[model samples]
Target: MTLTLYSNYVNSAGERVRIALALKGIDYEYVSVGEISWEVYERINPQRLMPALKIGDQIVPQATAILEYLEETYPKPALLPADPVLRAQARAFAQHVVSEMHAIDVIRVRRFLHNQLGVDQEGIDHWQNHWFANGFAALEELLARRQTAWTFCFGETPGWADLHLTPQVTKGIARFNVDMAPYPLISGIHKACVTLPAFIAATPAEQPDYPGRVIEPKLR
Candidate 1:
């Protein structure tokens, strides 16, 4: 089956799906939709979003939906946990990161903040920093709540939560000037994730249309 993903660098939602695709060892056609206008992207995804996955003749839009589709289709080496409760927990964590934390931390949103709301660059930076720190704080507490020690969120192995996390955290530190000091658990998991080949391959820097500086956060 030909899995064609329409994506771009700096699209956190797209990056989330990329991590899942890599984790499942799925080889896909990377079609660069970067630098496309909203009108153009709307042809692939009506929502005007990046990372629309085409499965055969059917098109799958939205990161969360695409992920669930992939998880169902690619069952082996599961991205979600086996146990039902753990699976729900993982979904909750991943969804929260994608929908809540990551939703506002996008380029368009920043553009909205600046162009529409009359916020300055410093204000935009402050806006991003505030929300990212809030998201990281919640994730830190969640990671600390469940386990004594885990290399990834929800477990030792990289799974659902890690998929959303690695992208968001990496982008956060790189672009938003997010501090990792308050999120030791999250920071540690990110460090461990970047070491893995799949996670590394799925990063924004590894994308074809990457034009920004790459982030390799200090694990110290």
Candidate 2:
């Protein structure tokens, strides 16, 4: 099976999919959208989103959807648990990161805040940080209540939650400069996840299109 992934290094959504591919030990063609011409990417995805996965002639858009496809196609590693309730929890956790936390802080949202709302850099930063804290606070409470294993969100091994958590925490530290100490469980899980080869290899800094100096934070 031939797989081609079109992604931008700076995008958290893309990073999530990339990490999943790495954990699955799937080798594919990595297309850096940042390095390529806009016309090329436009042809591939009219929406101009990063992290579009091409499986032969079929194209799967959206990072979360791509992750679900990967889990379905390659079930050996098993990103989600077999039990229906556990699977739903995993999906909800992933969605919390993507829909609740990530969706609001993406480039488009930031750009919209700056251009459309006339918000300055400080305002944008404040906005991002507030939401990050809010989401992390809720997640911390849930994890504490559930008494999640130290290794991962709901299981012994890194799964859907860990994939989403790592990238979001990475971005929170590197971009938003948020204090991770408030979310001990999240910080711990992120620390453990990044140590693995899959998470390390799929990090934004390790991507081909990464422009700036890599920020590797020492998670507390």
Candidate 3:
């Protein structure tokens, strides 16, 4: 199978899939779509989203779905817990990260606020920070409730939860200067995750299209 990942460097969703591929030890081609036109990318992905995985001839869009496909296809180092209840718990965390946290505060939404709604940078910053804080606060509480925890959120080894988390937390800190001192558990997990080989490889600085400061997600 020819696995090609089409995404920009700064995209969190793309970064998650990249991290997952590295964890699974799957060698695939990385195509930086930072400069492509929407018309061109739409041909590959109908939704015109980033991190679409092309396996042979089929194109799989959406980071969550791509992660699921990878987990089912490459089941050795499981990205989810083996226990049914624990698996549901892990999925719940991922769902929050992807849907509640990301869907609301992604670059596209920010762009719409700026371009269409005439929201200034200060307003956008306040908007983004507000939503991020809400999400992180909930996650911190969840982590605090854990009786037994490992380096990652779900276990000692990195899982899908960690993949979703590392990018969001790291990006929030790196770009927006998010104050992590409040959430010790979330902050610690982000710090630990970056040290791993997979996350190190998937970071924005390591990507081919990383051009210093990346404001937009470049979901071309």
Predicted structure with the largest lDDT when compared to the true one: 3
Candidate with more favorable, higher TM-score: 1 or 3: 3
> Against the true structure, whose TM-score is highest?
3
lDDT of 1 by residue, 49-156 (tens): 777999998798898999989989998788888888878888888877887777877677877778888888789778888888888888888887884476677776
Q: How close is every model to the real structure, measured as TM-score?
A: 0.91, 0.93, 0.94
Q: Which order, best to worst by TM-score?
A: 3, 2, 1
TM-score of 3: 0.94
Two-way lDDT contest, 2 vs 3, winner: 3
Residue-by-residue lDDT tens digits, candidate 3, 1-220: 9999999888889999999999999999988775776678888899898989999999999998899999999997999988787788889888888988899888789889988898888898899899889999988888888767777798888898899999999888887788988999988888889999999999888898899767654322
Q: Is candidate 1 or candidate 2 better by TM-score?
A: 2
On the 0 to 100 scale, the lDDT of residue 62 in model 1 is: 90
* Candidate 1 clashing pairs, residues 3+ apart or interchain: none
Worst 10 residues of 1 by lDDT: 211-220
- Ten-residue stretch with the least lDDT total in model 3: 211-220
Model 1's TM-score against the true structure = 0.91
Clashes of each: 0, 0, 0
Question: What RMSD value applies to candidate 1?
Answer: 4.4
